[model samples]
Target: MSLARPRALVFDWDNTLVDSWGTIHAALNTMFARMGHEPWTLDETQLKVRKSLRDAFPAMFGDRWEEARDLYLQAFEALHIERLSPLPDAEVLVQAIVARGHYLALVSNKTGRLLRDEVAALGWGHYFAKVIGAGDAVRDKPDRAPVDLALDGSGIAAGPAVWFVGDTGIDMACALNAGCVPILVHGPEGGLLRDEEFADATPARHFRDCMALAREISQ
Candidate 1:
């Protein structure tokens, strides 16, 4: 599939831009332990931790979901910044895109405060016009609310001119729901999860890594 040059870009912050699974896994395990549940293995964390805590916790913890959420948040907040790590060439890619004058925003399922904290910790806050995260919008990703909130003040509408680059099926689905061009930048392993999971929301372009995507966009 061919990619249209973008006027603005909306990015996914977790695995798409940064490698945050370590912190996420640890935090999830801490919550599970507190609740007397079996902790997920790292692989299970990777496979199951896609949706926002608000969206995913209820299913995992039933009536005690809110408590689980608080526990997970506390655990995550305590260590997230220390555990933050950029994927290969992700920082350079974002800097290069900003240098080229493309308007940028981040739309992540990560909690708003934590997401912004990580962004600030990395000193990359200036690169984004908006950093929309969970609870920042009326609804989170896979819904159009976060996408709309992200582009709210940019004077840019959501459509093909807006490229949504992310690594998960949820991100692809969000792009489609928002009428933006969906571009998948899978992590280094490049499976991008199961194909059937997002079969209805196929991406317009797919890149194995951020560096490859950066090269194409810079051209």
Candidate 2:
């Protein structure tokens, strides 16, 4: 199916525009060690890390979730900025999309302060109309709350015309919940097969990378 040109574009941060798995995995392991939990391998981290800390930590750490949260955040803040890197053609894609006059926003499961910090660090803050991260709204992604917050003052409502681009099933679920068009961007290593990992909330479109998605939008 052909994609409708988006009236607005909403992007996910980690693994969508920026490559953050290494930072995420390292931080998670750091937290695991301090909490006396088993450290996850990179592949395990990729598969298991999805929901926000508030949403996922309780399940993992029970009553000690807050402690785990603090530990994880400290480790992440220490390493994320130093190791942060953008995916190939990510900035080019953002520039091209903005140049086409489409309203843009960001909705990420990453913590709000950390997400904004990463954006500012990359000098890409100006590219988005609103950057809604975890805890920015009453609820996180897949609930449609953050999606609403992201588009709040943009004069754009969440619908088919708003393309929610990301790299995970959570993203596709968010798009589906918010009535936006789900657009998946897979990495060069080929992560998240649409028919397999995302069968329940499949993307409306898929691209191999940022460059491919950029080309599709340009067409």
Report lDDT (CA) for all predictions.
0.89, 0.92
Best by lDDT: 2
Across 1-219, the per-residue lDDT of candidate 2 in tens digits comes to 887789999999999999999999999999999999999999999998889999999999999999999999999999999999999999999998998999999999999999999999999999999999999999997789999999998889999899999998899999999999999898324444535668788788889989999988777
Q: Indicate the residue-level lDDT of 3 in model 2.
A: 72
My TM-score estimates for the predictions, one after another, are: 0.95, 0.96
Residue-level lDDT of model 1, residues 37-124, one tens digit each, is 9989999998888898899988988999999999999999999988889999998789879978889999999999999999999999
Off by over 4 Å in 1: 187-194
Candidate 1 pairs with clashing backbones: none
Ten residues in sequence with the least summed lDDT for candidate 1: 187-196
